[model samples]
Target chain A: MQQLDNTFTALSDVTRRAIVARLADGEQSLSKLAEPFEMSQTAVSKHVRVLSDAGLVIVEKRGRIRHCKLDAAPMKEAIDWLKYYEAFWADKFASLTKHLAKD
Target chain B: MQQLDNTFTALSDVTRRAIVARLADGEQSLSKLAEPFEMSQTAVSKHVRVLSDAGLVIVEKRGRIRHCKLDAAPMKEAIDWLKYYEAFWADKFASLTKHLAKD
Candidate 1:
């Protein structure tokens, strides 16, 4: 779906990839996610928004804190699509080896 | 690799995805690849060049024909990376279901 596209597109950014990697450890507040990077909090917020929109992250407000947790559904879909293509390449590579051997 | 990044970024475009899908069938000359699309041959050429640089396609010149064939090496890497993330999600989802059942 369009959400899947947005998720993949957002994940394509290096900054967003790091955010997802951080969230993989455990849920963290918005400030904590932004702390390690030199980027401004506003920039980190935008990256988090992209991940949340992609369903890669779940954001919830508890008291005054915005906690982010990895959702993982969209990541699974992206991975499924990638795995299919990976199998295709494995076949292609095997054939390539055979073709080269025949030469 | 930077080339891999460029290839994935280029392929993120719908036009380039169409071009790669077309090249998957068999080797085709530059003009043949451009003919079906309403886009200019120059635009198609740019897409083809991006694919060629990504190592997704092999280009060889025989007479005036520039034939492009799917290379599949970089595609293998991208798919492999995606597969790893997909497995992570599967585990996360399984855990989520268990927690939900406990509720």
Candidate 2:
């Protein structure tokens, strides 16, 4: 899907990937997630924005704090695309196995 | 791995993704791979080059023909990286299930 391109592009950035990693562990406030990185909160928010735009991260506001979490559903598309090759390789390997057995 | 970003980046293009999808069916010569698309063989070659650069596709030249194939090895890193979020969601869902059972 076209959206998968956006998803992959969003994840291409190391900072965005790091944000996803942090969110994967648990829901975190923007401030807390921004703490480990040297960048300003605005810069971190931009990374989060990109991830959110790509549907890889979901952000929610609870009272005064906004928390972010990883949404892995779109990630399935990326993995599914990759997994097709897995099946291809498996099929190739099976044929190879059969060929070897014939020898 | 930094290369994982390139792997994802390469697959972001629709033409490249189509090339990968085609390759997944079986190994194909460059000319054969280019047949379905309206683009020239040179354009197809460029897409293949991007895929090769990302290590997602492998090309072998035998005789006068070059065979192209899908390489799923590097894909494992991308999937493995995503599976970490799978664990996260599994953990979250498990806790929710436990809480529901208690109610």
> Highest TM-score: which candidate?
2
- Which predicted model would earn the best DockQ? 2
Error of 1 at B36 (Å): 2.6
For candidate 1, the docking band is: acceptable
Error of 1 at B70 (Å): 1.5
- The candidates' interface RMSDs, in order, read 4.5, 3.6
Interface RMSD of 2: 3.6
Instruction: Write one digit per residue (lDDT tens) for candidate 1, span A11-101.
Output: 6677777787676666799999999899899999988987887778889999999999877667565555445445436786676883584
Model 2 stretches astray by more than 4 angstroms: A62-64, A88-92, A95-103, B88-103
Q: State the lDDT of candidate 1 residue by residue for B5-79, as single tens digits.
A: 654465566676677677768789999999999889999998888878776777889999999877655766665
Off by over 4 Å in 1: A1-4, A92-103, B1-4, B91-103
